[model samples]
Target: MDDVAGIFARESPYLERYVQLGIASGRVLSVSFPDAPDEDAEVDHELLDRIFDYLSGVEDDFSDVEIALTVPTDQRRALDRVREIPYGDQINVETLARMTSGIDHTDEDDLNTVRTALDQNPAPLLIPDHRVRDGPSAAPPAIEQKLRSLEGL
Candidate 1:
């Protein structure tokens, strides 16, 4: 597997934040925070539409949208668990660690591993890392909070 940091640095460009009225279920897809440099970058119309719909209200489902997030193989299980987190709910690190404990055939989902998986999550809303929090140290805290507020949770 590739190094997580290297993957993030290389794949940063593809990560986009966009919103479309009737396109993506009124959801927003962003790689970073609104104020980040990549915020104003151009994105595909279809993708924006999907993001809009996904973030809209209750009809957002991105199972059809194909996205690639590169991380260590061990983290895949935890990331999948992160994605499984409901749109309007959040989970703490300990809980996530417990949930994903046996996924990798070992206790690889310790606190630090889970934290790294979340912090390096390439797709935020798609994976919904904002829903996982353990205090001010959660990955992408500001963006996570914004997403949670958007969901009215």
Candidate 2:
């Protein structure tokens, strides 16, 4: 399990996204989008099975899992705020920025700052960065829409 982490992917005519999970010491260490595998992810079959099972339902939330955010100091607070967003709920970037303002002194306007932090989020599904949006900041727009649709948002 140390050498091999589970990789899970889902696709539909309207949406496609890949989720890679690296676990160490029972905690999720790293999560990112890797190039799609050419073949099935059969190396870590059991882990991928569980992840796929959880993803099958729209209401399933990963908040119970411990996720690490190894991001820049300036972006850490904003990312944390994103994690607090309850499942099935979405918030505007302006609101997220205002909530994270106390983290550091910066120009009062935090829309750009918050958007930048979220744009660079490494763990999209785990952190639910798609919930933080004003207009089209959500990457791979179709996937974001699909995630929201799944959550019934």
Candidate 3:
């Protein structure tokens, strides 16, 4: 997974780990959007185009590729606000809705909002469940002793 931000590739610690694992295991291509707001009306067509271009270049390495979009919980309200916008030719409402509502899995309000967005845009959106990585197997004895001493203070 290559993270392209504003037409330039960027580094993300979390994505680096994920991509490293995926590439090593020869898993399907999975691209994620970690910090993009849900209601971002302009879908960053340039970024998407670049991503697709990159994907096309790598088509031979992986047989299948998928896109995963992540949005913060706070961005739902912004999506609601987007619905009220005039949404001139500058934006694609369907794509915006799909990207925004892709990972909404909270309560009735969120579900309804997601449903509405999906109803408006029936494309399948990838929503990844947050997975916690296991920490180090064991700490050095000296480090453990230091931690124990600190706990007693």
**Alpha-carbon RMSD to native, per candidate:** 8.7, 4.0, 18.1
20-80, model 3: which lDDT tens digit per residue?
Answer: 1111122212333334332322343333443344333321211133322134443443234
Candidate 3 Cα deviation (angstroms), residue 95 = 20
Weakest lDDT window of 10 consecutive positions for candidate 1: 1-10
Candidate 2 runs further than 4 Å off: 1-17, 23-35, 38-54, 101-109, 135-139
Q: Single out the weakest 10-residue window by summed lDDT for candidate 3.
A: 128-137
Candidates by lDDT, descending order: 2, 1, 3
Candidate 2 structure quality by residue, lDDT tens digits, 82-137: 88888778888767766784643356545556767788776677778877656343
Tell how far residue 147 is off in model 1, in angstroms: 0.6
The best candidate in terms of lDDT = 2
Per-model lDDT? 0.54, 0.62, 0.29
lDDT of 3 at 47: 33
**TM-score of every model versus the real structure:** 0.63, 0.69, 0.18
- Candidate 1 vs candidate 3: the TM-score winner is 1
TM-score, cand. 1 vs. native: 0.63
Steric clash pairs (candidate 2): none
- Candidate 1 off by > 4 Å: 1-30, 34-43, 101-109, 135-140
